[model samples]
Target: MKKMPHLSFWQIWNVSFGFLGIQMGFALQSANVSRILSNLGADLHALPLFWIAAPLMGLIVQPIVGSASDRTWNRLGRRSPYILGGAIIAALAMFLMPNASIVVSIMPVLLFGLLMFALMDGSFNITMQPFRALVADMTPEEQRNVGYSTQSFLINAGAVLGSILPFLLTNSLGIANTAPEGQVPASVIWSFYIGGSALLLSVIWTVVKTKEYPPEEYAAYKGLDVKAEIDPQYKGFFGFFRLLKITPKTMIQLAVVQFFSWFALYIMWVYTTPAVSQHVWGCEIGDSASQAAQDAGDWIGILFAGYSLFAAIFSVFMSKIATKIGRKTVYSIALLIGGIAYCSTFLFEGGEMMHVNLLFTQVDVPSSAVLWMFPMIGVGIAWAAVLAMPYAILSESLPADKMGVFMGIFNFTIAGPQILSGLVAGSVLRFFFGGEAIYMLVVAGVSMFLGAISVIFVKPSKSN
Candidate 1:
């Protein structure tokens, strides 16, 4: 491809706007769902099993959607339609999720909502991939870093709001502080509604304002294959199946890293509240019948927001860092940093009284503030690479025509780790240490270091 003039700042901003909304949904879910599930009476060990729906749905949905979008064309275009569709589905799921505990058989209601959430999530991912491909397809090599950086910025901006919403609403508005047994708080409900609306509106703004280069215009970009050429014989199931075959070596390497990384994250999310409550608040898990459990849930939201806040800031500089060092080396260092953060959870335990400040009558400010803040900073840095590195590497390695399918397969690795974490982390903590939640963080630390080690082996893509 011939070198083109650099994109205007607004051009980069316009193309990346939709991610602002998408991250609102993603951050809310990642930060809050485990808290919601726990409040609804889900056992820690079984929490992962419930989350199974997310990955299971992704496994089925992302590739199919990716392949379909790859073949599609029209006024709406291939990717935009999926983005619009996902926004609608996600909006609906957000509306329904906070109310799940109110319905009959909380487990079933939660599962049904999770399914809807997964559908919406999958659609968003489908739209996301094509936008990424479009950036790579359209931007000059010199500006690719800037384009991706803009997108990551928008993503973290969305996450910042999404992560903070619950705490902001519940604390500031004086919304119903406590729900009846088995019900979600009014603050949480309102937050999801706001997130859903924000998601839809942001996506619409992008759809209306930004224009994708058509196949002919896009073809002008050097090194692009606009023909959408694939082996016609491979349209059938067997042909698709044949393309699906990946080297066992690659699969083993990716699968191991993905498993540990995702497992660690899942453990952190699922157990953080309980850990904080038990170790920091000195509250027994089932002993809280009032607003205490819900309060813990809110703190989790704050911590998540803190991490996302840093991620937004770090993303702006990630590309430069990747360029200065090798991408793999940068990623490895980031994961190690995150691992250190995870392991730091142990220091916060049993030091609650000295750490917390009693600001007002009967009101104690959390003493372990430094513990949470420092790790969150590390998380933010690690997240920059988590968002970009693997996909960047994979994009460089795969053939253009196979991008969607291979990316879909990659999603499985990401989701599979979450599934494993949820299934095992809580039970292991419960069984081994009589329900001490800090152990889960230890597990996460170990897993993160493993992911760092795995980074050493990912060969840099020459094409990229």
Candidate 2:
């Protein structure tokens, strides 16, 4: 195999910069969507069902985008057009999401919210799947870990910004955190507008600063048949299925790990608001809009910011030890820590448990939100690994020509599990956990532990 020439650090940074916007959009979506859904009168038990749009839309979009990007070449190059286009659409969706009531005044609020939710997620997947492929497309095998770890850093860094925005606007900028009944708050609405603008600007920076390889040059470097013409029979319609059939084994093994990791994440994104409101702040959020519920929601954004801060600080650093400790071991250990952390949220005892001899614990939840920050440390570690290692390992195994399709297929491991979570989480919450959202976090911890084990079964590529 021909060894691809390594680019300087700034080159890699420029190319990966687009992920900052993509993840910022994602952070805003995940941190706020549940609160938005709750405000629209979604029942606690049905929260997971409302979240179905994101993953299901990704399942439909990623593979198709991936397959299509593999064949496309234009003035914007193979991937930039998709990145640019998706960012614009998703930014519009972001601005419109907080206005769900006004955006679909004629339709029922929840139904309209679902449509907007799917558009945001679908547009995100369009940008996201290509970005993952772009990393594989641009970097050499020896630099894959560095490429992905840097991507992880940017992702969490953007999340830090997006996650904290509403809280900052509410507290520092004096935007109203609470609104009239059935209406979204000014704090969240303003945050979305500013975040949408930032999303577009950040993506534009990447598109302008970076250049993709011309098709012939890329094919030649990857040892593909540069001279071969596309067979007309398989041109437009048959591409995705044909590409799907040829997915690599390492990708399949990694899929098992992805499924569990994302399933845990889906539960976290969909339920964390209500869980924090009820479990920590002791607020009821059904039909009646309480100031306490809004406060709890903003605080949850802070907790998410805390986690993103940890992930950003630790993300790129994972690359240093990934080779030394072994990628699988590092990934597994990180997730084990996260799994244990998720389960420990139940141990808080309301910030003043030192005198209680019956429980026998030293941990005190001095302030309610401070206690929640503890679990994010472990989650940050796992997030770093999940973003970097699987892709670093999988990039080495994928056929260069089909990298996009395989990455999209790999996304199914993410979207498919979240889809399953949507199907199952509500029932499990109502029937098994007696409508407590805290237990769902416990289930997430168990799922992460299982994901850690599954990743160990994957074989590292020869390039590694």
Candidate 3:
């Protein structure tokens, strides 16, 4: 058998660039969906429940998608087809999401929007797993880190744009900034439109520009036959359940970290807009006209952008930081820093309480820049490990043929944390803090601290 050629830098970039589009869709959903739902009259306490579909769908979808993609091989390629399909679905869902309030007596529109989001989200996960595996399959062992870094950089860049679109479009284009109660404003509508287009185009670019290795190449890499015995019944619903019964102690131990990280993230996603408007600007729900709400929406976008900015800057520094003091130490410290940053959300309300810095010749302390960078720096460092380290350890330990199934099952930890956060964060705020959105940040802080502490116990695979 011929030795596989090493991929060039651009080759890695081309294959990974699709993540830019995928992350953009995710950025829009994470940063703006809660705020949009609030504009559509979702109560702060109820927001978590409304957003439950994303994680729940991910829980059901990711493993199934991963499993299916593991067996798939087609003309468009195993994962590229899923990417194109997801982009199209997400685009349609983005178009309709902001329009849900239009058909006044049709409750189904809301459910339809949610269902479309689920489909789009699930399809993306389907593409994501195979893409990760592709990187491992195609790259030489020495270049694995660089390959994944390119992918992460693309992911964050896409997220930066996705998180900032509302601010740029609303402020720059003069779109209708506000709408009557229960309506999404024109600015947000346009943001989603542009995002959808970018997402579709970026993924298509990757699909066209890059090619995956054939099954023979893949089989040769692992010393397996190109053709294998088929077990069609292994694809059944109960198959995942049966597989779920056996799991690694390492994965079970890491659940502690996943639970905390996801809980903190969910709190931030669900309440950041309300927390900022209510806590910083003293704008209560229905307190002022839609303009106040619109201002709140724009500010939310800016704050999300702040985090992304920090995340991008920090991504470059993560490898160095990890090298100086083991990856676990860096991860633990970053979590602690993130906990501190989350705590800052409760310290100010309605305006700037602490003078932070200036951005673009404007005082940005409280508007969206305060403490935002700090949390994100921590978040970025944490994200480095979240995407790579755990998987690295797992891949080194698991049997090669079973990688697909084990990795699928492993994502359950990510979904499990989200489920816990969705179940708890809202009630904690309502009952403990009297429905104040700021309190949710405190809950997030605690969760981060807990997640960080769990890092102490993560024993990387001995083989690695």
Q: CA lDDT, every prediction?
A: 0.70, 0.83, 0.70
Off by over 4 Å in 1: 1-5, 101-108, 222-229, 246-256, 286-289, 350-363
Which residue window of length 10 is worst by lDDT in model 2? 355-364
Candidate 2 regions off by >4 Å?
230-239, 285-288, 352-366, 462-464
The C-alpha RMSD in Å for every predicted model, in order, reads 3.3, 4.5, 3.1
Across residues 1-464, which tens digit of lDDT does each residue of candidate 3 receive?
45567898899888888888878878888877876776666666877887777777768766766676667678877566766776777777777777877665767545655665666566666656666766665665556556666676777788888887877766566667677777777877888888878888888888898887677776776566677754554547776676666556666777778778877887788887777677666677534245555566676776676666666666666655555676678667778888887886665555554453334323233444354455566565555556655554455555444456667677778777787778877788778888777778887888888988998998866322
* lDDT value, residue 186 of candidate 1: 84
User: Which of 1 and 2 is the better model by lDDT?
Assistant: 2
Candidate 3 clashing pairs? 279-349, 280-349, 280-350, 281-350
> Which pairs of residues collide in candidate 1?
1-222, 48-422, 355-367, 356-367
On a 0 to 100 scale, what is the lDDT of residue 168 in model 1?
Answer: 78
lDDT of 1 at 345: 75
